[model samples]
Target chain A: MTVKLYIDSIHDALQEEMRRDDGVFVVGEDVGVRGGVFRVTQGLIEEFGEARVIDAPLAESAIVGVAIGAAAYGLKPVAEIQFADFILPAVNQLISEAAKMRYRSNNDWSCPLVVRAPYGGGVHGALYHSQSLEALFHHVPGLKIVMPATAADAKGLLLSAIRDPDPVLYFEHKALYRWIKDEVPEGEYTVPIGKARCVLEGDDITVITYGLMVHHATEAARELEKEGISTELIDLRTVAPLDSEAILAAVRKTGKVLIVHEDNKTGGVGAEVSAIIAEKALFDLDAPISRLCGPDIPAMPFNPPQERFYMLNSEKIAQAMRQLAAF
Target chain B: MMNAQSLEVPAMIAKRHDKLGLTDHDVVKMYHFMLKTRGLDDRMWLLNRAGKVPFVVSCKGQEAAQIGAAFALNPVRDYVLPYYRDLGVVLVFGQTAKDVMLSAFAKQEDPNSGGRQMPGHFGSREHHIVTGSSPVSTQIPHAVGIALAARMKGHNLVAYTSFGEGSSNQGDFHEAANFAGVHRLPVVFFCENNKYAISVPLRKELACEHVSDRAVGYGFPGVTVDGNDPLAVYAAMKEAVARALDGQGPSLVEAMMDRMNPHSSDDDDRTYRSKDELEEVKSHDPILSFRDYLLDCGVLTEASEKALREEVTVEINVATTYAEKAPYPHPEQALRYVFAE
Candidate 1:
């Protein structure tokens, strides 16, 4: 039995990786002394020295660039951006250099670096703080984008991401950092990239989601069960190398599909999944595919009504399932 | 790799030919390389004009400095992370003129691109030259990275990367220099300050007196050399490379050369600058000054100089022809070279 382990999974992953490998080090603003704003890196500086738990200058590009350099030089660096929004400054390093290094160099050099950032909405992080920008990274090839929904998966995926040969952007939803916890293996384990897990299996309507939205979808699935509508909830563990087979199978069985993400409605991961379904399994669909996501403009405000309206919740997921089931 | 001690002084003087170098062979080689580079530049410009090639960032005025720097290290070992305007440096680092021409032509036979990259995006694994990209100052950190790798591997090899004055404005430049200094990596950050970034003057881009002065802030030794004088540039690079190899750390050396050509084939200087300004810079061309120094040293006689120019012209002409005749890459091959399977 997977015993319920209620702890900071990200912190657990960091501790495990740091202990497991000599090269594994964490570097970020306030990550060392302050233990990060959310305390994800708490007690790491005490465990490992300052060199391993580096307190870098407040330069995102430098942080990413230095990590790339360190990784190429044979150190496994887990660099954290205090917030996901501030990752823009280092976008070029991540997108251009880190992504294309292996491809352009013909695999002469591989950047085995992991950039961990706390992302997604629901903590009243506002515009600058809360953002589901995984789609932006998902669009770029040669990069692996992982957004773990569960505590167990978070530890496994974070470890795998650290060990992976290519650069991995491990986007940790700030909402799920401590809000949701389950049995995460105490020993070393890895969840394969490009594999989606059916967290809750049903056959009526398939709801594809990832990260914090997975929990939301599960809530919606339970609510739908009360109405005799069995919903299949899939958590897309890795966004970039998506598990098309799993998605195709789910669609084939359920004959109906609803893609949900915390990102903006237009051009979200749902759009890509929709396109993939259209391209591959259009005939398998029983009804038109639907997407439940934040309204497309920018991240919404912290106001109770505006936040409730703009953010996608279990209610929104249930609404989509009802509409899809009715069709 | 060749013995560093034997090549150090000669290579240094070869790099900065007008300085107090007592060697005649070094000056002659400097003249030869400059002439060779200038010839290639002239051919490439004509190729662009004649519609045989698409684009070029000519290294005509910066040959002496580029070649002198190239001569400072063993081409077989030290890795060079060159920029678009570093054709001369690329050639000196063991890339064939034909290979570079084919790259410019975007042919399937182009070693640099394999028909994937645009013209002047040069790279050669055989030459230990890391691939060049269009992004400004991106290679600065990569060079430091390679140096860091070499240092970790316990190989005393140095990484040399060069870019224009414009590239110094990039945040990557600052980051790479800072990290290299902090880690004491064996890397040389060569800033080819040609006074103008395209049409944007150095004054508009930088408030500092020279590009090298910024190195002091990064906690490394910085020096400004007469980039037009290959001897001075070579001397500076040798000193820097030696310091790095001896585990001293990275150093920044600004080569104050001239931007004789417009920023690239796509750019026209006449749109932004007067002919007077163009002529003023052209008068101090590195190739011309190096040629004069060779003549003074009696290393390059009129007959020899004529023969050398003819030889280089023919070599470049043959390369141009080979590039033109080379087949364009197949449409399906576009996705081939992105990564190694």
Candidate 2:
């Protein structure tokens, strides 16, 4: 195992997968020659020639629609949407086309396509770039959404996504691209999708989160340990098919639950996690379900104070955990 | 239907068929497909009126363009992403009359969607026809991907896609065309301009004179031909296919025709279109006009024409009965196929 950045882990997955399978190819606006805006696809085009590494036109619908076509054509295409916020333009393709292809065709056709988009806030990307749009996609049944919080899971889940037999929307938090680094395995590892990993085990309070928020929750859990407030942390690797077993198990252990995310508060991913806890683990809950998320403003502000207020950090998450523990 | 054997004007002769390398048998086969498409489509409308099927989107006036274009390509090697009104294209690509009737009936054996999608959403893996959706012009980019795959996989195949003229106004068409042109992929954009998008006139549908003209913005040659003339549309499609195979890039061929019926069974086009206009467009129906052209070439005798009609009618009737009797999929089966097992 070697310590690597989240971005490098994703890049290694693409490079390794392309080397492993001839059917896997990468396509996006600046994926070739320029690596990517976030450098998550660096060094892929150099190893795979231009035919395998494509720079598509600035059309999100075509990028995804063409990827759907290639997937139907029996090729695994890893299409990169530059940012999660810009994904709205291609929602029709993602929802109407890719999501329903298999169900509509009665399994006669399936698009084994991986759409990688960088999501979440805190990088000052403003409205056009720094939005957490996971909620917009999770409700669709035939689609799968994977959000990796650790470098190891980044490499592992992406490998699994490309190999999966259906469309998978892999969202990597842009804020954690270079900021988060962990010991990733040497080669060829997979973190099975729709599963969660327990980062820290305690009995006082349970915190469920994914993407960059997982790091913030981990930091808060570590800080609370020194203060005698025990915290259990579960990083939900995939948001769509919420790891209900793990979530219920953790909630049953702690008797209290707190969900955290960077997306807007109203109708965000945490609401679903909260509802799951309230429904299945209702008898086990010791207190009301609590959630910490971005405020219901349109988006994160560009200014520092407003951005700080709109975002969640270790201090904020620790404060929320402290309150939940006392309750 | 008026049989125009006596009106065999010299100018309406089959002089252009040989020049385009279409044997007499080939044109006859094309006419037969046009006839078959009309037969199947007509039966579906009667089924709709009789309360057997729920909906009907007629392909009345565009048979020549669909049949003409489908015959020009290598159906075995190429990928086709057809839209909702492409009964003629899918028929030529090997979707059987029974398969279509099954789709129309939404039965268990419907190969397209197993009774999931509405009729006209076509797909057949053995026939190399990619499954399509009801959304207009969305299949354009999918065609680009198939063409890109052909080039990448080193396969000698071209990808073909067709849509109504109104679909040309979609951003998907522009984006797909631009991407295909930028990469010089093996693709042919066939637009069956049948003149109406659910009661909106062509004048409101496009700002340009022809749907093919938009291909110039994407760096491709664009041509508009009389869609009622199967030989003319076939000549254009054949040329476009050859150009795509040569790696010269994509081309746009627009077959200009008319909508011989309302947009669908549910629509009342009489509100927007004059009766005279509908009657005028009906006079140029591709299925009828192409049959006359085949007769003028001496390839189709009156007796042979009768034999073809009998053959198509029997085929359609058998398919209709088989689909009408077919069992529906178990309601529980709808829970399956969401993800690969």
Which of the numbered candidates is closest to the native, going by highest lDDT? 2
Q: What's the lDDT of the predicted structure labeled candidate 2?
A: 0.90
Model 1 ranges off by over 4 Å: A1-27, A33-36, A39-53, A69-77, A102-110, A185-188, A303-305, B1-27, B74-77, B148-157, B181-184, B337-340
> Model 2 chain B, poorest ten-residue lDDT window?
B1-10
The segments of candidate 2 whose C-alpha lies over 4 angstroms from its true place after superposition are B1-15
Query: Which residue pairs come into collision in candidate 2?
Result: none
Model 1 C-alpha lDDT versus the unseen true structure: 0.82
Per-residue lDDT over A1-327 for candidate 1, one digit per residue giving the tens place of the 0 to 100 score: 254332377788789888988778887788988988888889999999776787776778877877876676577889899889999999998888888766665455568889999888878877888888888888888788999988888888998999887889999888786678787777787888789998888989999999888888899999999999998888999998899999898888898999998899787888999898889999988898888878887787877687777788888789889999999
Question: Whole-model Cα lDDT per candidate?
Answer: 0.82, 0.90
* CAPRI-style class, candidate 1: acceptable
